[model samples]
Target: MRFLRAAAQALGGGLFLTLFVVFILQVTARFGFNKPLPWTDEAAVVLYVWVILWAAATIVPEREHVVFDLLWNMAPRRVRLGMRIVGNLVVGGLAAVAIPATWDYVHFMQRESTPVLGIPFMWVFLPFVFLMLALVARCAWAVYTALRGQGLEAELHLS
Candidate 1:
């Protein structure tokens, strides 16, 4: 589990760096050289998708995703646990639905190609599907941990 978390964080970090570099190159080429890299826009967009998705996967284990913790803290212990489980279940269901739907959309887009990148449009959408699936898995794991009486506060060192 620690290895997976480290891997996710490394992947997210690499994607973020790629995005930053691509964006900087794009800006530099367009304004400074009056010529933009043909693949820069598409590459940046794709990198952004990967970064956002992978970052979520990386952060989930760390309990960095946004939550209404104030309300959760005010609730009774049993209520809090129930709410956590229910919330995870709902998120998991949404992810399950999103994965197939997004994949279908990506499949449809596979028939088309991006202008500059010449890559299938599906390439952009596929990462989103993967991201949703990762989120689903992360949610399931969270619920499992909670049920085992291992709350995020205990597992994660927020400081």
Candidate 2:
């Protein structure tokens, strides 16, 4: 779990930093040199997508996502437990369904390349695939812990 979280953080942070540097370079090239790289915009967009996806995948695990738990708090203990299981299963199913479809879509685009960089679309879709896999794992873990009467916070080693 620690390794996976670290990997996500590393990948997301690296991509974000790359995006920033690329933007600065883009600006320098366009305004300073008056020669904007056609490939820069697409590259920046790709990097941004990766950063966002990886970062977003950590929300549930980190408990950083905004939650208005008043409704949850109002629920009876048993009902609350049921809700967590149901919610995790539902979300896990969604992620499971998305995986194959995303794979197919990215595969279909394998023959296609970006106009400027000639980078395969499959390469760009890699981060989305990682994100979907992470979601599936995270949701499954959520369901497992909830079913065992142990919440995610416990698994995460929180007090």
Candidate 3:
């Protein structure tokens, strides 16, 4: 688990670094050289998309996610348990249901390519499919942990 966490962090960090480099190149080329490279702009945008989705899918902890938990904090342990299980089931189930269509749409876009780089659209939007799968897996694990009555402590204050 530690290795997996480290790997996810590394991957996210690498993507962010790549995006930063592309942005710097874009700025430098436009202002310093007075000749903007179109590919840098597209690369930066694509990398930005990948970095954000990758972090959300693999790096962000569940506790760090935004939540409206006033009722959860006030609820009894039993109710909280029910809420956790039900909430996870609903989220995980929806993600699972959407996977087929997501895959289909992503696959369908393989015919299209980015204007500057000529990279396939499927490659660009592929992280969304990864995010969807991650959601389903993460929520399923949360549901399992909630069933075991673990990791369900109510926060005293929102972070």
**Among all candidates shown, the one with the greatest TM-score:** 3
- Which 10-residue span in candidate 1 carries the lowest summed lDDT? 150-159
lDDT of 2 at 40: 88
lDDT of 2 at 37: 92
Please state the error at residue 140 of candidate 1 in Å: 1.5
State in Å the error of residue 15, model 3.
0.7
Clashes of 1: 0
Q: Give the Å shift of residue 71 in candidate 2.
A: 2.0
Q: How accurate is candidate 2 locally (lDDT)?
A: 0.80
Model 1 Cα displacement at 38 (Å)?
A: 4.0
Best lDDT goes to which candidate? 3
Candidate 2 — which residues are off by over 4 angstroms?
A: 58-62, 152-159
| Predicted candidate 2 versus true structure: per-residue lDDT over 78-125, tens digit per residue | 877888889889988999998999999988889999888988988877
Tens-digit lDDT track of model 1 for 1-159: 789778877877888898999999999999999998878988998788777766665555445655546677667777778887898899898888788777888899989987877888887667677677788887898799889976734132344
- The models' CA-based lDDT, in order, is 0.77, 0.80, 0.93
Estimate candidate 1's alpha-carbon lDDT, on a 0 to 1 scale.
0.77
Collision count for each candidate, in order: 0, 0, 0
Error of 1 at 76 (Å): 1.3
* Candidate 1: clashing pairs of residues: none
